[model samples]
Target: MAESNCTQVTEFTLTGFTDNPVTQVTLFLMFLLIYLVTVLGNLGMILLIKVSPQLHSPMYYFLGNLAFVDLCSSTVITPKMLVDFISKKGIAYAGCMAQVFIYDLFGMTEGFLLATMAYDRYMAVCHPLLYPLVMSPKCCFQLVTGSYLIGLTNGIGQTIGMSTLSFCSSSVIDLFFCDISPLISLSTSDTTLSHVILRTSACLFGVSSSLVILVSYVAIISAILSISSAEGKRKAFSTCTSHLITLSLFYGTVFFVYLKPSSDSSREDKWAAVLYTVVTPMLNPLIYSLRNKEVKEALRRLTKIK
Candidate 1:
């Protein structure tokens, strides 16, 4: 029996959405715009929340953290992807690993953050009078800290698993960045253990966070229906609706990419990946900020101050 000659990949080539130069250029421009918007929007959100005392609450605190995560997450993957679109070689092995670490960190962090946001909304809308008591500063700190801890643990586990895997042969990654799926696919050695670890990690972090969000929303909807006044119900629903939209966009695309069977994954599926990684991050600020009067008013006040 011959030993598999798998060593660390020297360099990895990225096959972004297309090989056509024209299409690549067009896609590059589009993603550039999305990336720019994601950066500015998220930055603006963080600044707005920081400067506006009125926006300082458990809800905005979570929202600010979400914006920060989205910004960093988008930056981790998109900039490299954009450069890869035009560059001769996409990324080196070290660069790829760095991407993997950062991408996983922020992605997992956002998952936990989303769940935290859901819980925050649940407390605020369902138990308005007790919102302060339930989501006290201490409790809010615990929730945010917990979110970071969960994400950090999962990210470290996944990164360690990926680091152990040997990649000797074809170092070409089909997708835009060094995603776990593509990395696993590219490995020359037996990947059963790695796959097991990956699946377990996914279940531990991805599935559990999603389940928590789902339960929170269910309780939230129930609470909303119990309200007697229609206007009151509308007002309550509006607060969390943007969060729901952002959550759906994020989890939907992630589940599609990671959870789906290989048989179902196609070129089109890669496009779907773009929706969450690129499009959704940019849309989050718009969804949360534009729709919320508080954010708008804060922006207005900031503008007037300027």
Candidate 2:
């Protein structure tokens, strides 16, 4: 009986932002512009890092990978979301599950990458003499590969937990994109195990990574304070200011959405989702390039060569 009921929901109707034609058109145009900028900006960052000899360092290497992740994360959701604004927003169960898995994959990877970046920054600031040895090419590659591996594991676990449940209730998800909370609300079977999986993964990836960032920054700050000159202090802080901003933006909205109970999720949660999912990717390149002198110089050099 449960199997038959679960099989009944082949498709889900997404209750997107608005039903008004004018509003939809307006939002569609806005999101389209954002998506275009996101694609161009992240791609430009990656290309600049690739071609610029000045950017051939451990820092920029990680940065290039970050741009790739941001580009992919935005592409996964923004195109479908833009289409939903114009047409009837319906998604097959398989498609929805795919979205959930990919979304979780990128989301978790981004968090781990941020923590890795924090550790990189800490090494650079706190141990300048040993930075090259400690953060060698092999080490950096391993860190990034580990981040993706962890993300892949979490994605598989979450998707399996979600798939085992029976969505026999209503087929309407009250968000712009598919997420664990909304899907859990629609399940007819007991979701205790699923919730446990969700919370456990959240702690394992989210909270643990956050702790890594916190500890790294604390040591970073201590080392910066030990600098004898004001100019030296300023330079040290400047190196990480952009990363600090990006981390705050990404984690702020993520924690707001995921840390709370599903029953507590509301329309406000959707808007918060928009921040990390859509807006953060768009802003990452801007924040990094605008704030970092090295990136700006690389852009100028590349433009002259072109």
Candidate 3:
């Protein structure tokens, strides 16, 4: 009966990137450009990988999936955020939850997929003789399946956690979109369990995935150094450097945002979100393709396709 005292809030007012009209306009335009480029770039990458037989390896398979994740993740957050900037009102509770769920799905998938990619790279570079046996199509498929399994588990768990919390009071979320932290803050119900769940989820999905990638790369770097031929070493290093760069940027921002305690004035949180959600997606195709002559050639051939 005491729990019935809770009031139900239908909508949430978003305190967007900035309250300043000028800043909002500027951010809107900038993010619009970022979103457009992210879509074009990731779509193009996926298409290129799909069409090119040379890109049919486990590495490219994961890269294509990564592109897919980036595209979906950006779609979840950026467009609505853009609308929020232009429109007077913001997102509703249901809409926010839907976005949050999808965002969690894609983001969590990306983390797991990246770790899987690292393992793929580890086999390819560290044990080239066994690469064929290790990275068979079935194995690759299993890896990708495992990633989605993790993503689904995380998404459903978080979504349900969010759903159980009653947002009966102020629904104004002080962010561009509804995130777990802000949503938890808005809930009228006690969020102790929710917070613990979220923190545990973060560690399981985010930190654990990053650790797997880190360890895989550590082994990879060692293997690269052991190559006696300078040319062999150069080629091996080049193949992985771009991936490592993207990995660093993605995980760095993610760890900074999720692993740390929340502070309202934390510019790092906003910037980290931008980095992982907007900037990373836009940059992935370029980073992966520019370093990959095969991908560049594939794009060239794709453009020339009649």
| Lowest lDDT 10-residue stretch of candidate 3 | 259-268
Candidate 3, lDDT over the whole model: 0.85
Q: Pick the candidate with the highest TM-score.
A: 2
lDDT (0 to 1) per candidate:
0.85, 0.91, 0.85
The collision pairs in model 2 are none
lDDT of each residue in 143-259, candidate 1, tens digit only: 888888877776777777777777876778778878888898888777887688788877788888888888888999999999999998999899888988988899888878877
Q: Give the TM-score of each candidate.
A: 0.95, 0.96, 0.94
Clashes of 3: 0
227 in model 1: Cα distance from truth in Å? 1.7
Q: How would you encode candidate 2's per-residue C-alpha lDDT over 54-121 as one tens digit per residue?
A: 99898898888889999988998999999999888999999999999998898899889999999999
Q: Report the error of model 1 at residue 221, Å.
A: 1.3
* Candidate 1 weakest ten by summed lDDT: 1-10
**After superposition, candidate 1 runs with Cα above 4 Å error:** none
TM-score between model 1 and native: 0.95
Q: How far is candidate 3 from the true structure (C-alpha RMSD, Å)?
A: 2.0
Error of 3 at 257 (Å): 1.4
Q: RMSD of each candidate? A: 1.7, 1.6, 2.0
Clashing pairs in 1: none
- Model 3 — TM-score against the truth? 0.94
